[model samples]
Target: MNTKKQTGIHTGLPKLLLIALSLLTFTVIMTACANTKSAFPDSEGKIKITATIGMITDVVKQVGGDHVSVVGLMKAGVDPHLYKASQGDISKLDHADIIFYNGLHLEGKMVEILEQMAKKKPVAAVSANIDHSLLRAGDEKMGTEYDPHIWFDVRNWMKATEAIRDVLIEHDPDHAEDYKNNAEAYLKQLEQLHQEITEKIASIPESSRVLVTAHDAFGYFGDAYGIKVMGLQGISTASEAGTKDVTSLRDFLVESKVKAVFIESSVPRKAIDAVIQGAKEKGHELKIGGELFSDAMGEDGTTEGTYIGMVRHNVDTIVHALK
Candidate 1:
């Protein structure tokens, strides 16, 4: 009887040990999974981010600091309105951990592609947080539901910075403090930029504050800075200005006694040139003020390539030419 009892006890001990080992293995796996779920990219492991335009890319870089590696799809002088994603761009988007775009139909041709990619990964519009009341309406010709050029207004861009900061925090809680600090710094810079622009624009006498350009990209800018903006084409560069449009703008320039009109870096100079010719034909000589960073920033690695630099250059040009 004693021997039988000993054998039973020994067999039961092995079964209990087996059960304990299985439970231990299960707990280890679940803990590893939880860690993986919570982990975010850090300096050791950088996040891969893709931005649609240079403006968005610049902001992301400033906010993300060193924890992120960003790839900007559209380069300087590239028109986002008509830009379509190439195969390489599509591949980049697919591999990115996150994506940022201007939205509001700004990237008109890439809208569908972005929508599809959003299903598999986190895709954000930098302008998502901007108040709708602050936005301008788009004309029917542009096929835009709203004017997509929100970055022209410094205030609007500030809202976008907040949005980007919030997204980075949500994704990388480990670096939340870092992102917050960086965002605060960038916001302060933007505030300073706004003040500088205001003073410069104020230097221009109110009557001569008329800004004419290739397209309706500067409506928000004019509204923010108290300048009256006129563009030959509609909101989107996809829309072309006809002879009638040029003639009408020319008449307005002559009647308003505007000293200078401007050409855009991304837009063809032909429309503006035509307007100039039309004004000359009517005996009103209007010079092209200077090339403005519209739809895109200046060349990469230049001061105008940055968001703050682009805004400053634009204000300086406008004030110098129109003042």
Candidate 2:
């Protein structure tokens, strides 16, 4: 036997030792790669940002521009009030350099998870800086907390935009100028949007400004745009609309002779349909004005997906139906 150890790859270490050394080297490389990828500007040279909802994601995308990669956990027509964080969402949150959410209990189910994550990273509520006075008091059924739908009013959204801009600047100062410029441009666009919606809403008669919907997500919109909003469900969709609630809203619709009630994209249509049936029984003809984007925006690529487009679509829908 040519057992002269056939001058092969010779290592003094045992097989087990060789294996351990291989694993160690692999782990070190992996750790180095992970550390490099986790840097503020990721491997793609963009900050990794995660947002709880599409609205916040839109704002971040508008402001972060090319310097950030955003992941929105909530899709169109997903209700934030009832949304729970998934394992994938947790992973995204863990990997994100920063996270943005509407806050003020909008994301009811995920609040605890988000709170816990806040201790470890920059988790910010885009609506955090809004003056408390501007917020509508949440209905008692919805815990009587501050309403989290601050994005309804353009002014409030401006505040949210500012908060987002500030956070982006704080976390990634290298792109501070980009964020500032983008925010300023977006603010101007929002100002224009506000004026446009105001003028369009002005076309609707004051008496017809009643905006009945599936839920009370539009309280801020109503308050800002001079409409009377009523919903079978409370501010949070997590609250069910009882029979009594349906009956009461039906009576209100009949009494006020409100011509149209709206359905929300995120809320189930059953409740609104019940109200419609109840109204029909009372001899009031109520139409489903249109589906409004509440607690969510429209599809991603459509114009309605954008904040400006969503607001405009809502204003136009309200005016077209009620006016």
Candidate 3:
């Protein structure tokens, strides 16, 4: 008997565990639904929206406005690529009227739980609103179909705002006008933000407009703003940077005379430091420009916590460091 094939391929222990947990949550969710009355806050007249990441959480807040209550599964500095849903999360999902996520497997492990919840509730991927042709295809490093960091591009992120507005309207037709007005206000702000970024990026000498980070989350940002982007790791931070990747990128920085590379608020600085040290050893001095919000945003209530403010901070940091 070909038990090898029958046993199924083992991707990794982490993946197996994620799958097992996903199944266990299924039963837990069912039991919780049978016993629990209200899984989320104040039983009220608002749409219960649960979002997977801070960026999407911001969209829900902006579009849903006064008519929706939102619960974000992932917090600031939380890496969604490695995030797993807990039992409490399952209860929240079970009670949510609608759920939003970045999709394209950005919430890599929580995907099954989100999809399972979709059988009963509305689960939408705001990233799906972006034009498919505009997406950056993932390479062997990411092992995915397309890159999931659409929030890096302000224009692409606007699509997320629109998607959220539409979803909210569909679910609550009573507030359709409110959702449209709020989204329109946000979109105008985003339009201005995109223009601001384009002009800011253009200010740097064309040769000097390079953005290096811990991972390849800035592909859309670079393509949209016309700057060069490189990362020590791949599209997913789950993949670690190798010795060869460090040395080659170090050589490129040295040869290109790139000024600075930025670390991420969510990612560790070790790999970026290694690349910097490698460049120094090879006769180049590269400074840590500043921390950029890549996968996550800044703390709540801070300017950088909001999407527009986050983009502004990133562009300002980049322009200051590179220029």
Best by lDDT: 1
Residue pairs that clash (backbone atoms under 3 angstroms), model 2: none
Ranking according to TM-score, highest score first: 2, 3, 1
Number of residue pairs clashing in candidate 3, backbone atoms closer than 3 angstroms, sequence gap of 3 or more or interchain: 0
For candidate 3, the 10 contiguous residues with the lowest summed lDDT are 34-43
Residue 115 alpha-carbon offset, candidate 3, angstroms = 1.5
TM accuracy, model 2: 0.89
Residues 1-323 of candidate 2 have per-residue lDDT tens digits of 34546433243447768899999999988975675455333437788898988889999999999989888899999999889888778877877889899878888888888889899999999988899988888866666578888988999999999999999999988879999999999999999998887788888888888999998888888888788888788888888889999998899899989999999899999988999998899888899999899889999999989888998888889899999
Best by TM-score: 2
What are the TM-scores, per candidate, against the unseen true structure?
0.86, 0.89, 0.87
- Please provide, for model 1 over 1-323, each residue's C-alpha lDDT reduced to its tens digit, 9 standing for 90 to 100: 99999999998998999999999999988965544333322324787788999999999999999989888899999999999899778866876789999979999899889999999999999989998888899776667778989999999999999999999999999999999999999999999999999999999999999999999999999999899999998999998899899889999999988989999999999999998888898899999889999989988899999999999999999999988
Model 2 spans > 4 angstroms off: 1-43
Clashes of each: 0, 0, 0
